[model samples]
Target: MLGVTDYGAFVIAFLLLLAIPGPGNFALITATGKGGIKGGLAATCGVILGDQVLMWLAVAGVATLLAAYPAAFHVVQWAGAAYLAWLGLRMLLSKPGGAPRTTRMDSGQYLRQTMMITLLNPKAIMFYMAFFPLFVDPVHHQGMITFAFMAVTVAALTLLYGLVAVLLTHHLAERMRASPKMANLLERLAGACLVGFGIKLAAMR
Candidate 1:
Protein backbone atom coordinates (compact mmCIF):
# COMPACT_ATOMS: atom_id res chain seq x y z
CA MET A 1 0.00 0.00 0.00
CA LEU A 2 1.18 3.48 -0.79
CA GLY A 3 1.75 5.70 2.24
CA VAL A 4 1.06 9.38 2.75
CA THR A 5 4.41 10.35 1.32
CA ASP A 6 3.82 8.25 -1.76
CA TYR A 7 0.44 9.87 -2.38
CA GLY A 8 1.79 13.34 -1.74
CA ALA A 9 4.69 12.92 -4.08
CA PHE A 10 2.46 11.41 -6.71
CA VAL A 11 0.03 14.33 -6.53
CA ILE A 12 2.80 16.85 -6.90
CA ALA A 13 4.32 15.04 -9.86
CA PHE A 14 0.93 14.55 -11.51
CA LEU A 15 0.01 18.23 -11.12
CA LEU A 16 3.32 19.30 -12.58
CA LEU A 17 2.85 17.10 -15.61
CA LEU A 18 -0.77 18.14 -16.03
CA ALA A 19 0.30 21.76 -16.05
CA ILE A 20 2.40 21.16 -19.13
CA PRO A 21 0.80 21.93 -22.51
CA GLY A 22 1.06 18.89 -24.73
CA PRO A 23 -0.87 16.88 -27.27
CA GLY A 24 -3.51 15.86 -24.77
CA ASN A 25 -4.26 19.41 -23.70
CA PHE A 26 -4.19 20.60 -27.28
CA ALA A 27 -6.65 17.92 -28.34
CA LEU A 28 -8.95 18.73 -25.46
CA ILE A 29 -8.96 22.40 -26.29
CA THR A 30 -9.49 21.85 -30.00
CA ALA A 31 -12.27 19.35 -29.49
CA THR A 32 -14.12 21.60 -27.09
CA GLY A 33 -13.66 24.60 -29.34
CA LYS A 34 -15.34 22.74 -32.11
CA GLY A 35 -18.01 20.79 -30.24
CA GLY A 36 -18.44 22.31 -26.78
CA ILE A 37 -18.57 20.34 -23.48
CA LYS A 38 -19.50 17.00 -24.94
CA GLY A 39 -16.68 17.02 -27.43
CA GLY A 40 -14.18 18.05 -24.81
CA LEU A 41 -15.32 15.27 -22.49
CA ALA A 42 -15.05 12.74 -25.27
CA ALA A 43 -11.48 13.72 -26.05
CA THR A 44 -10.61 13.74 -22.37
CA CYS A 45 -11.84 10.18 -21.96
CA GLY A 46 -9.73 9.05 -24.87
CA VAL A 47 -6.58 10.64 -23.46
CA ILE A 48 -7.08 9.12 -20.00
CA LEU A 49 -7.76 5.68 -21.42
CA GLY A 50 -4.77 5.82 -23.72
CA ASP A 51 -2.53 7.02 -20.93
CA GLN A 52 -3.59 4.12 -18.70
CA VAL A 53 -3.06 1.53 -21.42
CA LEU A 54 0.38 2.91 -22.21
CA MET A 55 1.29 3.01 -18.55
CA TRP A 56 0.32 -0.64 -18.14
CA LEU A 57 2.21 -1.64 -21.27
CA ALA A 58 5.27 0.12 -19.97
CA VAL A 59 4.97 -1.64 -16.63
CA ALA A 60 4.47 -4.95 -18.40
CA GLY A 61 7.77 -4.61 -20.29
CA VAL A 62 6.85 -2.88 -23.53
CA ALA A 63 9.24 -0.13 -22.54
CA THR A 64 11.99 -2.74 -22.47
CA LEU A 65 11.04 -3.85 -25.96
CA LEU A 66 11.17 -0.20 -27.08
CA ALA A 67 14.62 0.20 -25.58
CA ALA A 68 15.89 -2.99 -27.24
CA TYR A 69 14.26 -2.35 -30.60
CA PRO A 70 14.89 1.28 -31.27
CA ALA A 71 13.75 0.86 -34.84
CA ALA A 72 10.26 -0.17 -33.79
CA PHE A 73 10.01 2.85 -31.51
CA HIS A 74 11.00 5.13 -34.36
CA VAL A 75 8.40 3.59 -36.58
CA VAL A 76 5.69 4.18 -34.02
CA GLN A 77 7.03 7.63 -33.31
CA TRP A 78 7.07 8.71 -36.94
CA ALA A 79 3.66 7.26 -37.61
CA GLY A 80 2.25 9.10 -34.64
CA ALA A 81 3.92 12.31 -35.69
CA ALA A 82 2.55 12.04 -39.18
CA TYR A 83 -0.94 11.47 -37.89
CA LEU A 84 -0.70 14.48 -35.58
CA ALA A 85 0.56 16.63 -38.40
CA TRP A 86 -2.29 15.51 -40.59
CA LEU A 87 -4.84 16.39 -37.95
CA GLY A 88 -3.20 19.73 -37.44
CA LEU A 89 -3.20 20.42 -41.16
CA ARG A 90 -6.87 19.54 -41.37
CA MET A 91 -7.66 22.03 -38.65
CA LEU A 92 -5.52 24.61 -40.36
CA LEU A 93 -7.44 24.25 -43.62
CA SER A 94 -10.94 23.83 -42.30
CA LYS A 95 -13.41 26.59 -43.09
CA PRO A 96 -17.10 27.30 -42.54
CA GLY A 97 -17.40 26.48 -46.23
CA GLY A 98 -19.98 23.74 -46.04
CA ALA A 99 -23.34 23.99 -44.33
CA PRO A 100 -22.25 25.07 -40.88
CA ARG A 101 -22.95 22.31 -38.40
CA THR A 102 -22.48 21.84 -34.64
CA THR A 103 -22.80 18.57 -32.87
CA ARG A 104 -20.86 16.37 -30.49
CA MET A 105 -18.85 13.52 -31.99
CA ASP A 106 -20.32 10.08 -31.68
CA SER A 107 -18.82 7.63 -29.17
CA GLY A 108 -16.96 5.44 -31.63
CA GLN A 109 -15.40 8.32 -33.52
CA TYR A 110 -14.45 10.14 -30.36
CA LEU A 111 -12.83 7.06 -28.85
CA ARG A 112 -10.95 6.28 -32.03
CA GLN A 113 -9.56 9.79 -32.50
CA THR A 114 -8.80 10.18 -28.81
CA MET A 115 -6.82 6.92 -28.80
CA MET A 116 -5.00 7.97 -31.93
CA ILE A 117 -4.14 11.35 -30.44
CA THR A 118 -2.80 9.84 -27.22
CA LEU A 119 -0.99 6.81 -28.67
CA LEU A 120 0.73 8.75 -31.42
CA ASN A 121 2.34 10.96 -28.85
CA PRO A 122 5.97 9.77 -28.62
CA LYS A 123 6.56 12.23 -25.82
CA ALA A 124 3.96 10.33 -23.80
CA ILE A 125 6.02 7.18 -24.13
CA MET A 126 9.07 9.04 -22.94
CA PHE A 127 7.01 10.60 -20.19
CA TYR A 128 5.95 7.19 -18.93
CA MET A 129 9.51 5.95 -19.12
CA ALA A 130 10.79 8.79 -16.98
CA PHE A 131 7.84 9.23 -14.63
CA PHE A 132 6.70 5.69 -13.83
CA PRO A 133 10.07 4.43 -12.66
CA LEU A 134 10.42 7.19 -10.14
CA PHE A 135 7.72 5.71 -7.89
CA VAL A 136 8.73 2.10 -8.20
CA ASP A 137 10.34 0.53 -5.14
CA PRO A 138 11.86 -2.90 -5.57
CA VAL A 139 11.24 -3.83 -1.95
CA HIS A 140 7.54 -2.93 -1.99
CA HIS A 141 6.05 -5.08 -4.77
CA GLN A 142 3.81 -2.10 -5.49
CA GLY A 143 3.90 -2.00 -9.26
CA MET A 144 0.19 -2.46 -9.95
CA ILE A 145 -0.79 -0.16 -7.14
CA THR A 146 1.53 2.51 -8.37
CA PHE A 147 0.27 2.17 -11.92
CA ALA A 148 -3.33 2.50 -10.75
CA PHE A 149 -2.47 5.60 -8.81
CA MET A 150 -0.82 7.12 -11.84
CA ALA A 151 -3.78 6.25 -14.06
CA VAL A 152 -6.21 7.88 -11.67
CA THR A 153 -4.06 10.93 -11.40
CA VAL A 154 -3.97 11.25 -15.17
CA ALA A 155 -7.72 10.75 -15.48
CA ALA A 156 -8.44 13.40 -12.90
CA LEU A 157 -6.18 15.89 -14.58
CA THR A 158 -7.56 15.12 -18.03
CA LEU A 159 -11.07 15.74 -16.79
CA LEU A 160 -10.04 19.03 -15.27
CA TYR A 161 -8.40 20.16 -18.46
CA GLY A 162 -11.37 19.02 -20.48
CA LEU A 163 -13.68 21.22 -18.46
CA VAL A 164 -11.41 24.16 -19.06
CA ALA A 165 -11.41 23.43 -22.78
CA VAL A 166 -15.16 23.17 -22.84
CA LEU A 167 -15.58 26.50 -21.11
CA LEU A 168 -12.98 28.31 -23.16
CA THR A 169 -14.10 26.88 -26.47
CA HIS A 170 -17.70 27.64 -25.71
CA HIS A 171 -16.80 31.28 -25.34
CA LEU A 172 -14.41 31.40 -28.28
CA ALA A 173 -16.76 29.64 -30.65
CA GLU A 174 -19.62 31.95 -29.74
CA ARG A 175 -17.52 35.03 -30.37
CA MET A 176 -15.88 33.87 -33.59
CA ARG A 177 -18.49 32.03 -35.59
CA ALA A 178 -17.32 32.58 -39.17
CA SER A 179 -13.69 33.42 -38.58
CA PRO A 180 -11.22 30.67 -39.46
CA LYS A 181 -8.13 32.70 -38.80
CA MET A 182 -7.67 31.66 -35.16
CA ALA A 183 -8.40 28.01 -35.88
CA ASN A 184 -6.01 28.00 -38.76
CA LEU A 185 -3.29 29.56 -36.64
CA LEU A 186 -3.78 27.11 -33.80
CA GLU A 187 -3.83 24.17 -36.17
CA ARG A 188 -0.64 25.29 -37.85
CA LEU A 189 1.11 25.80 -34.54
CA ALA A 190 -0.02 22.40 -33.31
CA GLY A 191 1.07 20.77 -36.54
CA ALA A 192 4.46 22.38 -36.32
CA CYS A 193 4.81 21.20 -32.75
CA LEU A 194 3.87 17.68 -33.73
CA VAL A 195 6.31 17.67 -36.63
CA GLY A 196 9.11 18.93 -34.42
CA PHE A 197 8.23 16.42 -31.74
CA GLY A 198 8.22 13.69 -34.32
CA ILE A 199 11.68 14.61 -35.53
CA LYS A 200 12.90 14.68 -31.97
CA LEU A 201 11.38 11.29 -31.25
CA ALA A 202 12.82 9.79 -34.41
CA ALA A 203 16.26 11.15 -33.55
CA MET A 204 16.29 9.98 -29.94
CA ARG A 205 19.28 7.69 -29.35
Candidate 2:
Protein backbone atom coordinates (compact mmCIF):
# COMPACT_ATOMS: atom_id res chain seq x y z
CA MET A 1 0.00 0.00 0.00
CA LEU A 2 0.98 3.63 -0.58
CA GLY A 3 3.43 2.54 -3.24
CA VAL A 4 5.35 0.46 -0.77
CA THR A 5 5.96 -3.19 -1.55
CA ASP A 6 6.18 -5.96 1.02
CA TYR A 7 4.89 -3.78 3.81
CA GLY A 8 5.12 -6.56 6.36
CA ALA A 9 8.72 -7.25 5.53
CA PHE A 10 9.53 -3.57 5.68
CA VAL A 11 8.01 -3.22 9.11
CA ILE A 12 9.81 -6.29 10.37
CA ALA A 13 13.14 -5.10 9.02
CA PHE A 14 12.68 -1.64 10.40
CA LEU A 15 11.74 -2.94 13.84
CA LEU A 16 14.72 -5.26 13.87
CA LEU A 17 16.97 -2.37 13.00
CA LEU A 18 15.46 -0.31 15.79
CA ALA A 19 15.89 -3.15 18.25
CA ILE A 20 19.61 -3.15 17.70
CA PRO A 21 21.47 -1.34 20.47
CA GLY A 22 22.73 1.92 19.07
CA PRO A 23 23.51 5.50 20.01
CA GLY A 24 19.84 6.44 19.68
CA ASN A 25 18.70 3.75 22.07
CA PHE A 26 21.52 4.60 24.43
CA ALA A 27 20.45 8.23 24.49
CA LEU A 28 16.83 7.29 25.14
CA ILE A 29 17.64 4.97 28.03
CA THR A 30 20.13 7.41 29.50
CA ALA A 31 17.77 10.36 29.24
CA THR A 32 14.92 8.44 30.81
CA GLY A 33 17.10 7.20 33.59
CA LYS A 34 18.40 10.67 34.34
CA GLY A 35 15.31 12.79 33.64
CA GLY A 36 12.32 10.52 34.20
CA ILE A 37 9.47 9.95 31.78
CA LYS A 38 9.07 13.58 30.76
CA GLY A 39 12.72 13.91 29.85
CA GLY A 40 12.62 10.63 28.03
CA LEU A 41 9.59 11.71 25.99
CA ALA A 42 11.29 14.95 25.04
CA ALA A 43 14.37 13.08 23.87
CA THR A 44 12.16 10.71 21.96
CA CYS A 45 10.49 13.56 20.13
CA GLY A 46 13.87 15.04 19.33
CA VAL A 47 15.06 11.77 17.84
CA ILE A 48 11.87 11.42 15.80
CA LEU A 49 12.24 14.91 14.43
CA GLY A 50 15.86 14.25 13.57
CA ASP A 51 14.98 11.01 11.82
CA GLN A 52 12.27 12.71 9.77
CA VAL A 53 14.71 15.37 8.68
CA LEU A 54 17.27 12.77 7.64
CA MET A 55 14.71 10.69 5.79
CA TRP A 56 13.50 13.69 3.85
CA LEU A 57 17.08 14.64 3.09
CA ALA A 58 17.67 11.15 1.80
CA VAL A 59 14.60 11.44 -0.39
CA ALA A 60 16.05 14.67 -1.68
CA GLY A 61 19.19 12.83 -2.80
CA VAL A 62 21.66 14.10 -0.21
CA ALA A 63 22.84 10.54 0.04
CA THR A 64 24.24 10.74 -3.47
CA LEU A 65 26.22 13.81 -2.54
CA LEU A 66 27.55 12.07 0.53
CA ALA A 67 28.63 9.08 -1.49
CA ALA A 68 30.24 11.36 -4.02
CA TYR A 69 32.28 13.11 -1.35
CA PRO A 70 34.18 10.69 0.82
CA ALA A 71 35.82 13.53 2.74
CA ALA A 72 32.45 15.00 3.61
CA PHE A 73 31.20 11.67 4.85
CA HIS A 74 34.29 11.24 7.02
CA VAL A 75 33.87 14.72 8.42
CA VAL A 76 30.38 13.97 9.62
CA GLN A 77 31.43 10.59 10.92
CA TRP A 78 34.26 12.07 12.97
CA ALA A 79 32.05 14.82 14.30
CA GLY A 80 29.39 12.38 15.39
CA ALA A 81 31.95 10.12 17.00
CA ALA A 82 33.48 13.05 18.85
CA TYR A 83 30.12 14.23 20.07
CA LEU A 84 29.20 10.83 21.43
CA ALA A 85 32.55 10.50 23.08
CA TRP A 86 32.21 13.89 24.72
CA LEU A 87 28.86 13.00 26.20
CA GLY A 88 30.17 9.68 27.41
CA LEU A 89 33.21 11.25 28.99
CA ARG A 90 31.11 13.79 30.80
CA MET A 91 28.89 11.12 32.30
CA LEU A 92 31.80 8.84 33.03
CA LEU A 93 33.62 11.54 34.93
CA SER A 94 30.62 12.94 36.77
CA LYS A 95 31.00 12.85 40.51
CA PRO A 96 28.38 11.12 42.56
CA GLY A 97 26.11 12.88 45.15
CA GLY A 98 25.45 15.81 42.85
CA ALA A 99 22.19 16.75 41.20
CA PRO A 100 21.50 14.62 38.15
CA ARG A 101 22.28 16.22 34.79
CA THR A 102 18.70 15.64 33.70
CA THR A 103 17.44 17.72 36.61
CA ARG A 104 19.28 20.72 35.23
CA MET A 105 18.00 20.37 31.69
CA ASP A 106 14.63 21.69 30.59
CA SER A 107 12.59 19.99 27.91
CA GLY A 108 14.04 22.19 25.20
CA GLN A 109 17.59 21.31 26.08
CA TYR A 110 16.87 17.62 26.02
CA LEU A 111 15.17 17.97 22.68
CA ARG A 112 18.04 19.92 21.19
CA GLN A 113 20.71 17.60 22.53
CA THR A 114 19.05 14.46 21.30
CA MET A 115 18.25 16.06 17.97
CA MET A 116 21.89 16.98 17.50
CA ILE A 117 22.93 13.48 18.41
CA THR A 118 20.61 12.04 15.79
CA LEU A 119 21.52 14.53 13.11
CA LEU A 120 25.27 14.28 13.51
CA ASN A 121 25.27 10.57 12.75
CA PRO A 122 25.81 10.24 9.01
CA LYS A 123 25.24 6.50 9.15
CA ALA A 124 21.57 7.11 9.87
CA ILE A 125 21.25 9.15 6.70
CA MET A 126 22.96 6.41 4.72
CA PHE A 127 20.69 3.77 6.23
CA TYR A 128 17.54 5.66 5.32
CA MET A 129 18.74 6.35 1.79
CA ALA A 130 19.73 2.74 1.23
CA PHE A 131 16.74 1.12 2.90
CA PHE A 132 13.94 3.38 1.72
CA PRO A 133 14.26 2.64 -1.99
CA LEU A 134 14.02 -1.08 -1.48
CA PHE A 135 10.41 -0.80 -0.39
CA VAL A 136 9.39 2.01 -2.70
CA ASP A 137 7.64 0.95 -5.89
CA PRO A 138 9.08 3.25 -8.51
CA VAL A 139 6.40 2.40 -11.03
CA HIS A 140 3.62 2.95 -8.51
CA HIS A 141 5.30 5.77 -6.62
CA GLN A 142 2.74 8.32 -5.38
CA GLY A 143 5.30 10.88 -4.32
CA MET A 144 4.13 12.45 -1.07
CA ILE A 145 1.90 9.58 -0.07
CA THR A 146 4.66 6.99 -0.13
CA PHE A 147 7.15 9.24 1.63
CA ALA A 148 4.62 10.27 4.23
CA PHE A 149 3.68 6.69 4.96
CA MET A 150 7.28 5.69 5.45
CA ALA A 151 7.94 8.72 7.64
CA VAL A 152 4.93 8.02 9.81
CA THR A 153 5.82 4.37 10.17
CA VAL A 154 9.31 5.26 11.37
CA ALA A 155 8.00 7.87 13.79
CA ALA A 156 5.41 5.49 15.23
CA LEU A 157 7.87 2.68 15.73
CA THR A 158 10.39 5.03 17.31
CA LEU A 159 7.77 6.34 19.70
CA LEU A 160 6.83 2.85 20.80
CA TYR A 161 10.45 1.86 21.31
CA GLY A 162 11.25 5.06 23.16
CA LEU A 163 8.32 4.63 25.49
CA VAL A 164 9.36 1.11 26.34
CA ALA A 165 12.95 2.17 26.96
CA VAL A 166 11.82 5.06 29.14
CA LEU A 167 9.58 2.84 31.24
CA LEU A 168 12.19 0.17 31.74
CA THR A 169 14.97 2.63 32.48
CA HIS A 170 12.75 4.59 34.82
CA HIS A 171 12.01 1.42 36.73
CA LEU A 172 15.69 0.71 37.03
CA ALA A 173 16.33 4.32 38.05
CA GLU A 174 13.78 4.03 40.81
CA ARG A 175 15.54 1.02 42.17
CA MET A 176 18.93 2.69 41.81
CA ARG A 177 17.81 5.79 43.68
CA ALA A 178 17.97 3.84 46.89
CA SER A 179 21.63 3.07 46.23
CA PRO A 180 23.83 5.86 45.07
CA LYS A 181 26.72 3.53 44.38
CA MET A 182 24.76 1.33 42.04
CA ALA A 183 23.28 4.32 40.32
CA ASN A 184 26.70 5.76 39.80
CA LEU A 185 27.98 2.47 38.48
CA LEU A 186 25.14 2.15 36.01
CA GLU A 187 25.71 5.68 34.79
CA ARG A 188 29.38 4.95 34.31
CA LEU A 189 28.56 1.79 32.42
CA ALA A 190 26.20 3.66 30.15
CA GLY A 191 28.88 6.24 29.63
CA ALA A 192 31.35 3.57 28.68
CA CYS A 193 28.95 2.13 26.18
CA LEU A 194 28.51 5.51 24.59
CA VAL A 195 32.23 5.88 24.32
CA GLY A 196 32.47 2.45 22.78
CA PHE A 197 29.87 3.43 20.22
CA GLY A 198 31.84 6.54 19.38
CA ILE A 199 34.96 4.48 18.92
CA LYS A 200 33.07 2.03 16.76
CA LEU A 201 31.65 4.79 14.62
CA ALA A 202 35.08 6.24 14.17
CA ALA A 203 36.42 2.88 13.15
CA MET A 204 33.75 2.38 10.48
CA ARG A 205 35.00 2.81 6.92
Candidate 3:
Protein backbone atom coordinates (compact mmCIF):
# COMPACT_ATOMS: atom_id res chain seq x y z
CA MET A 1 0.00 0.00 0.00
CA LEU A 2 2.99 2.26 0.38
CA GLY A 3 1.62 5.54 1.78
CA VAL A 4 -1.97 4.76 1.02
CA THR A 5 -4.05 4.44 4.15
CA ASP A 6 -6.44 1.94 2.62
CA TYR A 7 -5.91 0.85 -0.94
CA GLY A 8 -9.39 -0.52 -1.38
CA ALA A 9 -11.02 2.62 0.00
CA PHE A 10 -8.78 4.81 -2.12
CA VAL A 11 -9.71 2.97 -5.28
CA ILE A 12 -13.40 3.20 -4.48
CA ALA A 13 -13.23 6.92 -3.79
CA PHE A 14 -11.25 7.55 -6.95
CA LEU A 15 -13.73 5.58 -9.03
CA LEU A 16 -16.59 7.59 -7.62
CA LEU A 17 -14.82 10.80 -8.51
CA LEU A 18 -14.32 9.58 -12.06
CA ALA A 19 -17.97 8.62 -12.30
CA ILE A 20 -19.00 12.22 -11.84
CA PRO A 21 -19.82 13.86 -15.16
CA GLY A 22 -17.34 16.53 -16.14
CA PRO A 23 -15.73 18.35 -19.03
CA GLY A 24 -13.05 15.71 -19.47
CA ASN A 25 -15.63 12.95 -19.87
CA PHE A 26 -17.57 14.99 -22.41
CA ALA A 27 -14.40 15.71 -24.34
CA LEU A 28 -13.57 12.04 -24.43
CA ILE A 29 -16.99 11.15 -25.74
CA THR A 30 -16.93 13.93 -28.31
CA ALA A 31 -13.51 12.88 -29.51
CA THR A 32 -14.63 9.27 -29.81
CA GLY A 33 -17.64 10.29 -31.80
CA LYS A 34 -15.55 12.26 -34.23
CA GLY A 35 -12.41 10.18 -34.59
CA GLY A 36 -13.40 6.68 -33.43
CA ILE A 37 -11.39 4.49 -31.06
CA LYS A 38 -7.98 5.91 -31.82
CA GLY A 39 -9.06 9.43 -31.03
CA GLY A 40 -10.67 8.33 -27.78
CA LEU A 41 -7.46 6.61 -26.73
CA ALA A 42 -5.45 9.71 -27.56
CA ALA A 43 -7.81 11.90 -25.59
CA THR A 44 -7.62 9.40 -22.74
CA CYS A 45 -3.83 9.77 -22.75
CA GLY A 46 -4.17 13.53 -22.82
CA VAL A 47 -6.45 13.48 -19.78
CA ILE A 48 -3.99 11.28 -17.91
CA LEU A 49 -1.03 13.50 -18.74
CA GLY A 50 -2.88 16.65 -17.83
CA ASP A 51 -3.97 15.11 -14.56
CA GLN A 52 -0.39 14.06 -13.78
CA VAL A 53 0.77 17.63 -14.23
CA LEU A 54 -1.83 18.88 -11.78
CA MET A 55 -1.18 16.06 -9.32
CA TRP A 56 2.52 16.82 -9.15
CA LEU A 57 1.83 20.51 -8.89
CA ALA A 58 -0.54 19.78 -6.02
CA VAL A 59 2.14 17.75 -4.29
CA ALA A 60 4.52 20.67 -4.78
CA GLY A 61 2.12 22.96 -2.86
CA VAL A 62 0.81 24.85 -5.88
CA ALA A 63 -2.70 24.19 -4.57
CA THR A 64 -1.83 25.87 -1.29
CA LEU A 65 -0.31 28.82 -3.09
CA LEU A 66 -3.37 29.22 -5.31
CA ALA A 67 -5.66 28.96 -2.29
CA ALA A 68 -3.84 31.86 -0.69
CA TYR A 69 -4.39 33.99 -3.77
CA PRO A 70 -8.05 34.34 -4.70
CA ALA A 71 -7.28 36.35 -7.83
CA ALA A 72 -5.12 33.61 -9.27
CA PHE A 73 -7.84 31.06 -8.73
CA HIS A 74 -10.40 33.28 -10.38
CA VAL A 75 -8.15 33.86 -13.35
CA VAL A 76 -7.80 30.14 -14.08
CA GLN A 77 -11.48 29.48 -13.45
CA TRP A 78 -12.56 32.20 -15.84
CA ALA A 79 -10.09 31.13 -18.47
CA GLY A 80 -11.46 27.60 -18.42
CA ALA A 81 -15.01 28.88 -18.51
CA ALA A 82 -14.29 31.16 -21.45
CA TYR A 83 -12.60 28.41 -23.39
CA LEU A 84 -15.55 26.06 -22.93
CA ALA A 85 -18.01 28.72 -23.90
CA TRP A 86 -16.02 29.65 -26.98
CA LEU A 87 -15.84 26.08 -28.17
CA GLY A 88 -19.54 25.64 -27.52
CA LEU A 89 -20.44 28.79 -29.40
CA ARG A 90 -18.43 27.75 -32.38
CA MET A 91 -20.19 24.42 -32.51
CA LEU A 92 -23.56 26.08 -32.12
CA LEU A 93 -22.96 28.50 -34.97
CA SER A 94 -21.61 26.01 -37.45
CA LYS A 95 -23.81 24.82 -40.28
CA PRO A 96 -25.48 21.49 -39.73
CA GLY A 97 -23.76 19.57 -42.51
CA GLY A 98 -20.70 21.76 -42.86
CA ALA A 99 -19.10 21.33 -39.46
CA PRO A 100 -15.54 20.13 -39.60
CA ARG A 101 -14.87 16.52 -38.66
CA THR A 102 -11.83 14.51 -37.74
CA THR A 103 -10.68 10.97 -38.43
CA ARG A 104 -9.02 8.32 -36.29
CA MET A 105 -5.66 9.55 -37.56
CA ASP A 106 -6.16 12.97 -35.95
CA SER A 107 -4.94 11.68 -32.65
CA GLY A 108 -2.70 14.63 -31.92
CA GLN A 109 -5.47 17.16 -32.29
CA TYR A 110 -7.79 15.22 -29.96
CA LEU A 111 -5.03 14.78 -27.45
CA ARG A 112 -4.09 18.44 -27.30
CA GLN A 113 -7.63 19.73 -27.22
CA THR A 114 -8.63 17.46 -24.34
CA MET A 115 -5.38 18.23 -22.51
CA MET A 116 -6.03 21.95 -22.79
CA ILE A 117 -9.53 21.51 -21.40
CA THR A 118 -8.30 19.47 -18.47
CA LEU A 119 -5.43 21.86 -17.72
CA LEU A 120 -7.46 25.04 -17.69
CA ASN A 121 -9.74 24.07 -14.79
CA PRO A 122 -8.51 25.49 -11.51
CA LYS A 123 -10.93 23.43 -9.48
CA ALA A 124 -9.16 20.27 -10.59
CA ILE A 125 -6.08 21.23 -8.60
CA MET A 126 -8.13 21.87 -5.49
CA PHE A 127 -9.84 18.54 -5.93
CA TYR A 128 -6.51 16.72 -6.29
CA MET A 129 -5.02 18.35 -3.23
CA ALA A 130 -8.06 17.52 -1.15
CA PHE A 131 -8.41 14.08 -2.65
CA PHE A 132 -4.81 12.99 -2.01
CA PRO A 133 -4.93 13.64 1.71
CA LEU A 134 -8.06 11.58 2.24
CA PHE A 135 -6.24 8.38 1.29
CA VAL A 136 -2.73 9.29 2.43
CA ASP A 137 -1.24 7.56 5.42
CA PRO A 138 0.03 10.40 7.56
CA VAL A 139 1.78 8.06 10.01
CA HIS A 140 3.63 6.05 7.37
CA HIS A 141 3.45 8.18 4.29
CA GLN A 142 6.34 7.91 1.79
CA GLY A 143 6.01 11.40 0.43
CA MET A 144 6.69 11.35 -3.31
CA ILE A 145 6.36 7.60 -3.56
CA THR A 146 2.94 7.66 -1.96
CA PHE A 147 1.67 10.38 -4.25
CA ALA A 148 3.20 8.70 -7.27
CA PHE A 149 1.38 5.49 -6.50
CA MET A 150 -1.90 7.33 -6.15
CA ALA A 151 -1.29 9.12 -9.43
CA VAL A 152 -0.66 5.87 -11.24
CA THR A 153 -3.78 4.33 -9.75
CA VAL A 154 -5.93 7.20 -10.93
CA ALA A 155 -4.41 7.09 -14.38
CA ALA A 156 -5.07 3.39 -14.70
CA LEU A 157 -8.67 3.84 -13.61
CA THR A 158 -9.11 6.63 -16.10
CA LEU A 159 -7.77 4.52 -18.93
CA LEU A 160 -10.09 1.65 -18.10
CA TYR A 161 -13.13 3.90 -17.82
CA GLY A 162 -12.17 5.71 -21.01
CA LEU A 163 -11.93 2.53 -23.04
CA VAL A 164 -15.42 1.50 -22.05
CA ALA A 165 -16.70 4.94 -22.91
CA VAL A 166 -14.97 4.91 -26.28
CA LEU A 167 -16.58 1.60 -27.27
CA LEU A 168 -20.02 2.87 -26.29
CA THR A 169 -19.57 6.21 -28.02
CA HIS A 170 -18.24 4.59 -31.19
CA HIS A 171 -21.30 2.40 -31.40
CA LEU A 172 -23.57 5.38 -30.94
CA ALA A 173 -21.60 7.38 -33.47
CA GLU A 174 -22.11 4.71 -36.11
CA ARG A 175 -25.83 4.98 -35.70
CA MET A 176 -25.72 8.77 -35.83
CA ARG A 177 -23.55 8.79 -38.94
CA ALA A 178 -26.33 7.21 -40.91
CA SER A 179 -28.68 9.96 -39.85
CA PRO A 180 -27.12 13.33 -40.59
CA LYS A 181 -30.02 15.33 -39.20
CA MET A 182 -30.00 13.49 -35.93
CA ALA A 183 -26.26 13.92 -35.73
CA ASN A 184 -26.64 17.65 -36.31
CA LEU A 185 -29.25 17.97 -33.60
CA LEU A 186 -27.20 15.99 -31.13
CA GLU A 187 -24.16 18.10 -31.96
CA ARG A 188 -26.14 21.20 -31.21
CA LEU A 189 -27.29 19.72 -27.92
CA ALA A 190 -23.71 18.93 -26.97
CA GLY A 191 -22.70 22.50 -27.70
CA ALA A 192 -25.44 23.77 -25.45
CA CYS A 193 -24.38 21.40 -22.71
CA LEU A 194 -20.84 22.65 -22.97
CA VAL A 195 -22.05 26.19 -22.59
CA GLY A 196 -24.11 25.21 -19.58
CA PHE A 197 -21.17 23.46 -18.01
CA GLY A 198 -19.03 26.56 -18.49
CA ILE A 199 -21.58 28.79 -16.87
CA LYS A 200 -21.87 26.39 -13.98
CA LEU A 201 -18.15 26.26 -13.49
CA ALA A 202 -17.89 30.01 -13.54
CA ALA A 203 -20.68 30.36 -11.03
CA MET A 204 -19.07 28.00 -8.56
CA ARG A 205 -17.75 29.54 -5.36
lDDT by residue (tens digit), candidate 2, 69-90: 9999999999999999998998
Q: Model 3's lDDT to the true fold?
A: 0.86
The reply for model 2, stretches above 4 Å from the true place, is: none
Q: Lowest-lDDT window of 10 residues in candidate 1?
A: 95-104
Residue 181 of model 3: what lDDT? 76
lDDT rank order: 2, 3, 1
Q: Which candidate achieves the best lDDT against the true structure?
A: 2
For all candidates in order, the CA lDDT equals: 0.68, 0.89, 0.86
lDDT of 3 by residue, 141-168 (tens): 9988999899999999989988998999
Candidate 3 has which clashing residue pairs, if any? none
- State candidate 1's TM-score: 0.80
CA displacement after TM-score superposition, residue 62 of candidate 1 (Å): 0.7
Query: Could you estimate the TM-score for every candidate?
Result: 0.80, 0.95, 0.95
> Which window of 10 residues has the lowest lDDT sum in candidate 2?
97-106
TM-score of 3: 0.95
In model 3, what lDDT does residue 3 have?
84
Model 1: how far residue 204 lies from native, Å: 4.5
